[model samples]
Target: MKLRLILSFFLFTTCFTAFGQEKKNAVIVEKGLIKVSVMYPYAEGKTFNMEYYETKHMPMVAGFLGANLVKYTIEKGIASGIPNQPLPFMAIGTFYVKSLSDYQAAIAPNRDGIRADFSNYTNITPVILVSEVIK
Candidate 1:
């Protein structure tokens, strides 16, 4: 058991080194919560698109960008703060990024693929916000 723990610790350290231990360009005002609120129109009915986004597209984009997915939630009833309550099926994903540059680099190469994934939807907007974890 002790040997296994030591090995795990070594592997963890090695990964940090490989990924660059220095935390450069970290925003002074770190983003606390990252939320992607996708608003879908009533005309098309977002069931099919939602499934595709969850099962296929989300993993690819998040994995490609090195962001650990926090969670995905769907809003069924009337959501607060909107006059008409526009968004029907909303999906939220949270990720901890070392820096904005790191996040940008991860998504830069996969832009084309990401765009294609949302092509079927009438309207799709991907929003990213970073924040510091509060102690």
Candidate 2:
């Protein structure tokens, strides 16, 4: 019984150690392959249109550009806040492209289509940015 228990514990420890090592090796966040950023803007009188853009326009835009909408952050702006005050409604999107020029060209022509889709909003505008993951 003691030998059996020891063997079981050894197997469990081996499996756990292997899984932990795999997780460390498999994580690609710090490999400088992924891109990330925030899109900042304001949303005061354009709640409905903003929601429409969040749900409809962005998905269509992503589909058109072959990109992915990673996340969306909506916050109220502060008058006396820091120099880089966050926008009220920002749709953060990230695209994993091997090259920056390719990413730019991918969404170059879709600008007109995206503009037409969100033409109803006068105040709503997207300020897109990207950053590479650093090791």
| RMSD (CA, Å), each prediction | 11.0, 6.5
**Candidate 1 lDDT, 1-135, residue by residue in tens:** 999999999999998886664555333334453444434434344433556666676667668755434444443334535677565434444444455466667778888977887776325454444555553
Estimate candidate 2's RMSD in Å: 6.5
Query: Which ten contiguous residues of candidate 1 have the minimum total lDDT?
Result: 25-34
Which candidate wins on TM-score?
Answer: 2
**Residue pair clashes in candidate 2:** none
Segments in model 2 whose C-alpha atoms lie over 4 Å from true places: 1-27, 34-38, 48-55, 65-90, 119-123
Query: Model 1: which residue pairs collide?
Result: 30-131, 30-132, 31-130, 31-131, 31-132, 32-131
Put down candidate 2 lDDT per residue, 106-133, tens digits, no spaces: 6678868767766653345666667675
